[model samples]
Target: MAIHFFEEDIRSEIQQKRNLKNWIKKVAAGKSFRIGNINYIFCTDEYLLEINKAYLNHDTLTDIITFDQSERFGEIDADIYISAERIRENADILGKTYQEELRRVLIHGILHLCGHRDKSPAEKKSMREEEDKALNLFDSADVPRGTLKK
Candidate 1:
């Protein structure tokens, strides 16, 4: 049951990692799944674009790409790649603070592992609702606001 964060070519780190980890565990448990070895790799948009092209065969920029690696049925193990640059741009476009957008992307990937999909309009709405619930869990707890270095 481990959640590790790494930087590929980004200049930022996740603040309050302990609290974030606990929150992630709780989110997974809420879906009746246990946490496994999950690695979050933060990188530049270009880096993530290369991955998107090479692996997913999509030649476009995306905020996140989740690779589910869970072996057991009820455990979540995956490598989630995030584009910090994209997140910042999206934050500005959505009129949200960087921290708020980052947290959304973070939980978005986890929610994917929890059997949530966003391919359709209804699924996207449901996914957003789940993301909001997870975010509320973080907000209503004793956790401090998380930040990323610029």
Candidate 2:
């Protein structure tokens, strides 16, 4: 499984770590973890706003918007468009580092592609549980408090 970033590079991500790959695999195993390509495109609010309007027909600002392009299971293919600007704001509200929040948003999109939906109350609860599970596994190391950054 490959995790790649397209334009608007996502630097400072933990995905590049060797241990991170193993951690992700362990968390995703027995799930629909595919051995194919998945693209994560990070962009500005304006870029994502255009995509959200043109594709999803929504005007509200969002942190992560995923476009799944797979035809079958075990072929996890998707484009996750993340708005750094939105995530930064969410980091403040959530009282977590931007990195932690970024990790949450990344897992959120992946969980969606894993046949997990966060629509109704029950589904939202389940989704949150899954997110917490993943975070518990991945956030063992202290997540650095993000400094004032633009």
- Which digits, one per residue and each the tens of the lDDT, describe model 2 over residues 40-67? 7778788888898999899988888999
Which model scores highest in TM-score?
1
Q: Candidate 1, residue 117: CA error in Å? A: 0.3
C-alpha lDDT values of all predictions = 0.90, 0.74
lDDT of 2 at 62: 85
TM-score, one value per model: 0.93, 0.81
Question: What value of lDDT does candidate 1 attain over all alpha carbons?
Answer: 0.90
Alpha-carbon deviation at 96 in model 2, angstroms: 0.4
RMSD of 1: 2.2
In candidate 2, where is summed lDDT lowest over 10 consecutive residues?
141-150
Cα error of candidate 2 at position 74, Å: 2.3
**Per-residue lDDT over 1-150 for candidate 1, one digit per residue giving the tens place of the 0 to 100 score:** 699889986854467677788888989999999999999999999999999999999999999999999999999999999999988999999999887898899999999999999999999999999999999999884555555333
